[model samples]
Target: MDKQIGYGRWKAPADVMARAMARMRERERAGGPRKAVIGSGKEALAEAIRRYPNDPLRQLAMFLDASPLPALIGRAREVSAKTRTNHGDMLRGAIGDLKAINMKVQRLDQLNRRQVMALAAYWTHEKGQTPGTVANKLSALRKFFTQVGRQDVVPKREALYEALAVTGVSQQMVTRQQVALDTKAWTPKGVVPLEVIEEVRETYPHEALLMELMLAWGLRVSEALGLRPHSSDTPNFLLVHRETKGGRWRKVPYMKDAQKAAYQRDVLNRCRQWAEKSRRLEMGYPKLTLQQARSRLYNVMAEIGVTLEQRGVVCHGLRHEFAGDMFFDITRHRPPSENGADSDWYKQNKTLVADAYQQVSEALGHWRREISSAYLGSPTKMSKAQRERMEQSMQLIAGNPDVKQGLVAAGVEQFWITGPAADGVLLRAGEAMQVAGRFQEGWTAENLKQVHEVLRAGVARPIQFVVSLEAQPQGETLEIFLDR
Candidate 1:
């Protein structure tokens, strides 16, 4: 029976949903072991059958009878598609003699996108799937789908690529690994100013230290919350070991003054409380879970005028900053972007960003050298002289009194012209917004709307302005550029 006779929705045949349910029920009638796992799996499988408009038996058989490699690969692919990590080995371990292929496909096809994405999230977040496991599964699935010749089974390759394209996966699996390697790195560092931490502290004193630790050390909120005085007794270092992402152990060495202070005082106190509550003094870490710490940190970071624009200032920014700082230190005296050439660390370490690429690789914990090498390339860096010239140009532009008055007088009107820098002054103007005559033609309402869209998407956070006011005299010559 054609499931999609009229409507697009697939309505399963009568036996499709009932097949698994019937089998489970028969097992129950025979006084089989009543296990929650079996029940849940059956229920889920049955539900999938009911939702999909296909023959379950035929699909399961098709999946089961294929050679071990293809079958293992196909199942692994399904797992990877459902979870964004690698689990080829686990998939192999879970594989059993295929008595039914048609049934498996029927059940799998019945699964909705939400179900698939959830399973994927759990696999990576809960089960700790490796990149290799994920890659093999993806490879297996690609082969299975290509061989199967089902339009529905053939996934959106682009989306699959996006989901599986971890830093190194592209290099090994995809044909355009080199091209992908050429792209700029998006390390997990934020660009929050050092002063912003002090400002946030003045407003919310309690969270000030926490904010500083996150920005300075790049410790995840959970790790920060679970900090301990006893475990972190080192004068210049704090030891961190937390179970996140499937109970994996990640140890971070902390070396910031703010972090050291927090460890001695507030953080140590919290750890004692947690230890008492859990009735375990063996591990003297704070009891606060990562989720709790992350939430509080998010709110605090937001209040401190932190935006995504400063790429190395967010919670994850600390690690990126650490890596970047090391990179700068290693290559400071040498000319820029010479990762592949002879240098101090490269000379001694016998490593090049283009060759061994050890710095970024070790920082990122990537398994492959190719993954770390991706960070070695940078097309955005300007020459030192060019950078100085750009700074001078900005100063020259900033020095013009008319430009300043125009920016200030226009207030909010000038905001769309210059983004957040003009926001504070514009807000003060309120209804008295007055844009300069020069902007009368350029700063149209349509243009402002477009600018807002660009600002919102480009910055990855809300806008903030540092406004300034100054005195200006009449008959001041205004030199306005057409670009403005």
Candidate 2:
């Protein structure tokens, strides 16, 4: 017993510690040891518990005694470091609210779903947070709780929705109210007109150059500020390697037109000067935070007598203008319904438009082509010419004996084909054909069969078909039956 007690209290080997613990348990189970022996064993056990509390039982007891918010905050910090997000700030904000409310939530298990919902409600209604902001906060809290193994505190999705509804912040509710409230006509702001651009140039020369970089290259403000002349592989282009929002690198040329090459050269020299000045002043590279740049731009605009309504043109608006100009230059056709272009013109040029948008999207460092709308606006509706071409394509497909037989066998009664453009075709159930699918640009009979199977299986979205075509004319031929 004395040997075992000594092993327990001292910095002993692992085997010795194990033997000491086993013997102590055995002695206690058999009967109380002699008083002198028991006293020493109890002291050793206490010391062992303090030194190595790695047992599951000990951990449980510690968790039971731990305060909920601080433990969650600590766990959130660990998670944020791993994820490289701002989760710590979000968690701290919640804790700040809890402290303000004087809630006596001390234990990890003290927070129930109701309390969580109430807190979310407070942020939504009382704090007047947007539904999206509240949603993000709730999501962060859920992740934090899950990480800490306190998932019981996380509210159910339904319960959260209920809380949002009570606060009059449901997506549908907000969207409806917004639509009803937008009574007056409002043009999208930030499309810098030429006059406005000229005014900015004369007023703030340095800022105007930065604005021109964004306008011409579709560069983000951060991308412009992080530019280094050393990053240029050639005299006329620079490789952008900064951590973009899309997490990609792209090459930005100085200018497409040789006439503007001198201007581009001048801009590059000025950017180098700015970077050096920033380094000398120790004010940070590019010398401005995004907010500071925006504020300076706003001040310049104000000095030029641009109204709040006309102030829609910002750095991002310049990027949008770049995208729009690129689209027009590539397609040589405006979006359908814009500038009085008929549906036929749009349909004929759908592929060109899609290709142009995709090129712009890649240049802008965005992975999704759909995101182009934020800059380019919604795609124009299909033109009459496009409808006619689609109809012609469908007629050709129906004329193919194998394709027609397959369609009949698959119970497809009526269908209308839309495009084999840059994106793909939109095949909907027409007056006679009962099929719904979006076939790829080069779909075949097998692909059509797959679409038939998916529709039969009750897939709601348009089934994607992969078919091949041979030497179809740019906007006239519908030679889709030929395999690639």
Candidate 2 lDDT over residue span 167-192, tens digit each: 55565422212111110101222233
- TM-score, each model? 0.37, 0.41
Candidate 2 wrongly placed segments (more than 4 Å) = 1-129, 138-198, 232-237, 242-249, 253-294, 306-312, 334-355, 380-484
lDDT of 2 at 236: 42
Model 1 has an lDDT value of: 0.37
TM-score of model 2 relative to the true fold? 0.41
Q: What is the lDDT of candidate 2?
A: 0.48
Q: How many angstroms is residue 340 displaced in model 2 relative to the true structure, after the best TM-score fit? A: 8.7
Instruction: List where candidate 1 sits over 4 angstroms from the true fold.
Output: 1-192, 232-238, 244-246, 250-289, 309-313, 333-484
Candidate 1's displacement at residue 327, Å, is: 2.3
lDDT of 1 at 318: 47
lDDT of 1 at 446: 54
Model 1 agreement with the true structure over 322-371: per-residue lDDT tens digits = 44444544544221232222334444544433433454443343334544
Every candidate's CA RMSD: 19.9, 22.5
Predicted structure with the largest lDDT when compared to the true one? 2
